[model samples]
Target: MAVMDDSRLAEELRLTIGRLVRTVRAVDTMPPGEAAVLGYLDRGGPLTTAEIAQQRGVSHQSAAKTVKGLLTQGLVRVEAHPDDGRKLLLTLTPAGHDRLAEERRRRADRLGRAINAVLTPDERKTLEAALPLLSRLSTHGTGE
Candidate 1:
């Protein structure tokens, strides 16, 4: 096979990945902002609203709006910060864990079905083989 241009490959890969994300997100049961907050809290709980805003790359008010909805839905709870009384720490509740798990399972099941329907066994293997490389590449994603 002929060698592909690196720049062209990068552009194509970026666009394709963006499209894939959009397609998968179509199955989301909740707004992406709320789901993202739930995911971050699950992975790193007891974070402050400021931290959530940083992680989300959104303004504090934007993160607050999402957190407010989660609070009303009983998916998250806020507690006074141990180190700083002025700020509140956010953590997922039991219901929040259940909801996040259900959401993940639903998305995974949909993706799994699509994969089974669309890809041949060898193609599936090839995609699986790319996962580690993709993961490694993503480690550079947060570089400033």
Candidate 2:
């Protein structure tokens, strides 16, 4: 196989991934910021607003606003921090988990339909084989 230029490959992958994310997210009604906070909590467990901000690389005010919106929607609950009396931690409620699961199912169905309708058998096999590489690329520098 001919080697592709590194920068060109990166740009192609970046654009493709962004498009994929947008397509998947189109089924959900939640605002991006609110959904993001919920997704972070779903993966990372309970965290303070400050921790969420730091993890997301956003300003504290931005994180706080996101958390507040989630709170208003009953998607997340805030509890007093176990180790700190003055701080609060945010966690996903049962409804939030259900919403996440439903959103995932919808996205999966949409993507699966698109793939089946558009891609050949060989292309499907190629995508199946690429899953691990894509996962690794996403986590490469995160120290996960």
Candidate 3:
């Protein structure tokens, strides 16, 4: 059999993943950046504005703006950092936790429904089996 064109395969995978992400994100209450910052905090624990910005691959000002929105929504709050009164820490408020949880549920449900409705049982199984390969592909260039 002829070898598959790596470029074509890469392009197809990139577009497919992008569309899938966009579709899931469309149902989310929070915008992508805000949701991402919230997610990083939720999983990685509280952090400073600069830390959040670094982890999210955005500028300090951009992260601050997103944080400000979260604050306005009462989703996150700033408090004095322990062991360092000079610095402030950002953490999710009770409302923030609730909002993130709901957003995640909605996105997962939307994607799950689409997969179940669109893919046959065998196809779903095939996709499930490809998870490891897909994950490897996703992290291929990363030093993780």
Candidate 4:
């Protein structure tokens, strides 16, 4: 194996991951922002638009626009916050659940096919071994 410094490894990881994400995302049927909103709602929702913006690391305006599109598509529903009457919370609709599931299935299929096609058995093992580390790195990515 070629020697790599920390910075070099970081750069390589960042670039390769970025490209891979783009490749996987290319198969998505919905816009990324909308898909993201659905995912957030699925995971930790009944969230206000401001909370969504904070979680997504976007401006309130951007998050609101995404919410609007989701609402229009019937993927998300808004309701009054339990504690705060003035604030509204968003929840994923049944359609939203199905849509999010489909989106995940499509991306997983795309990535799984590519992984099988491109990697040898040993390489596959190595990649699987790296998954935990990658997950940790991802967690640290959220300003943790």
Question: Against the unseen true structure, what C-alpha lDDT does each candidate score?
Answer: 0.93, 0.89, 0.91, 0.95
RMSD of 1: 1.6
Q: For candidate 2, write residues 22-57 as lDDT tens digits.
A: 887788767777777888999999999999999889
lDDT of 1 by residue, 5-80 (tens): 9998889899999988887888888999999999999998789989999999999999999999999999999999
Candidate 4's displacement at residue 117, Å, is: 0.7
lDDT of 1: 0.93
Name the better of 2 and 3 by lDDT.
3
- Once all C-alphas are superposed, what RMSD does model 3 give against the true structure? 1.8
Error of 2 at 132 (Å): 0.9
- Off-target runs (Cα >4 Å) in candidate 1 are 141-144
Number of clashes in every candidate structure?
0, 0, 0, 0
Q: What lDDT would candidate 3 get against the real structure?
A: 0.91
> Roughly what TM-score does model 1 have, to 2 decimal places?
0.94
Worst 10 residues of 1 by lDDT: 135-144
Per-prediction TM-score to the true structure, in the order listed: 0.94, 0.92, 0.89, 0.94
Candidate 2 overall Cα lDDT vs. reference?
Answer: 0.89
Highest lDDT against the true fold, candidate: 4
In model 2, pairs of residues that clash are none
